[model samples]
Target chain A: MPESSLRGALTEAVLYILLALYTPLHGYGIMQKVDELSHGRVNLGAGTLYGAINTLLDKGWIIPLAGEMDSRRKEYVISETGKEIVAMELIRLQELLDNGRVVTGGTV
Target chain B: MKHIVHKAYWDYEKEEQWLNEMSHKGLALEDYSWCRYVFRDAPAGKYIYRIELLDKTGSHYESQKYLKFLEETGIECVAAYMRWAFLRKEASLGPFDLYSDIDSKINYYSKVINFWNIFAAMELVIGTMNVLIGLVNGGRYGGLGFNFFLGLPLIGLGVALVKLGDPLRAKIKRLQQERAVQE
Candidate 1:
């Protein structure tokens, strides 16, 4: 993909991870949820997910939760702050979707 | 054998120019970032290289640093605020000792500092509680004096926190300034 396209996708990728973490999810789980929600259009790699998780943690939008430790896998959950941000993002997306529907004669 | 590794945040245009400049100096640009230049074949000793960052208006910010180590094989130096590791097959290079020293010092200092910050914050809370309690009792039975004594230790703790972290803070600031100059 083009660099600009990749940059644009990053914002959505971050939101998808936030949405997936509402019930607490691991890295792989978040990737799967993103693909599912996007109808398989967005397939985030492990490296990208790892980078996103660290960035989200640094920004205080996600927190690691206590977990069973059979493997090195860890679980994360969205914080209260993260929930609020996600809600705002959803509203913004809804507006965009509505605009698109109107432009496309409500077919989409 | 000589090896030169350039490290920096990738900027294709500027990097191409930098490569050209290095080529002119007879140094090969193996790798790089926006803020780092690694040069091999430097004489065995400490040497300082200057870095300059230019703004759109043509104004510049600059910094200088010594080549951390140099041996017959390659040179190991650090610029900007980033750490790097490089190897060249042809050259016998000395290990970059600066990173290890800085890392150990940072580890030691951070541990000491985190402990001190928590301890001082706790002391502040405790001291405030003591003073509040003494005031509520109207300073009866020398309570005011006792609270004042308790508060002194908190003040001391705060002072210690500042003293302990000050040097590290300054070092980080210096490093940041150097990085900005290399941008």
Candidate 2:
């Protein structure tokens, strides 16, 4: 895993999605999880969700789980690489918050 | 009761809005083929409608998979024509939007603009070629060949398509600015 490539901050959607996939979730479940986690602040539309899922799969950050042959509801779980990326993101967010408080001389 | 109407719309957003309006009037879109829309009576404001252009034909495997994914999310494809699909969801299912983020919206606009640009370029090229052929084969001052006349409308259509893409480009610009600030 290249730390340099993951240095950039993940978009809100991608970060939320990766967080949501801590447990295996299908498409609709992922959408619901994101919505709930964001407290309804983020709504993942179908098209955007589809595109993001494909991109994440291509990057190997997520792996689709095989279900029944007749089942169209494909589920996914975060890969080990994805967990490392999420950990980095957490550190990055903490830095942002710490920086804000230090500069403002007040708790954020 | 069922009602059928023939209409043409170059803008998918406008078509979507029009379909939503029809739903408000208790006319749910049952099917669509080309410019014809078939509607059936239903409770007013029963469904929300959306339309999108696929990168491939509706029958293509990729497109079908995409549609199937949407179905799992509770959206149904009412009809598909050429590369466009008419989608609908129950109005009570919260807000229905195919693109919820600025980046995705911009991506969609880019796709539409690219399609139109290609169409416009093809029209302009064919039109210019025909005009040149007509002028060279027929006299320049008079007796313009049939190709010259045939090319005029094609050129006009090309220009029209370009003009139509301008607003979408403007939208993309605005969305890009918004993304820069927000994301």
DockQ winner: 2
Model 2: DockQ vs. true structure: 0.89
* Weakest lDDT window of 10 consecutive positions for candidate 1 chain B: B64-73
The digit string of per-residue lDDT tens for model 1 on B79-115 reads 2332222222212322222222233334434543565
Docking class of 2: high
Candidate models: Cα lDDT each: 0.53, 0.92
What are the RMSDs of all candidates, in order? 18.8, 2.0
Each candidate's number of clashing pairs is 11, 0
lDDT of 2 by residue, B1-183 (tens): 999999998778789999999999999999999899999999999999999988888999999999999999999999989889999999998899998888889999898888889999999999989988888767865688889988888999899999888898999999898988896
**How many Å off is the CA of B68 in candidate 1?**
32
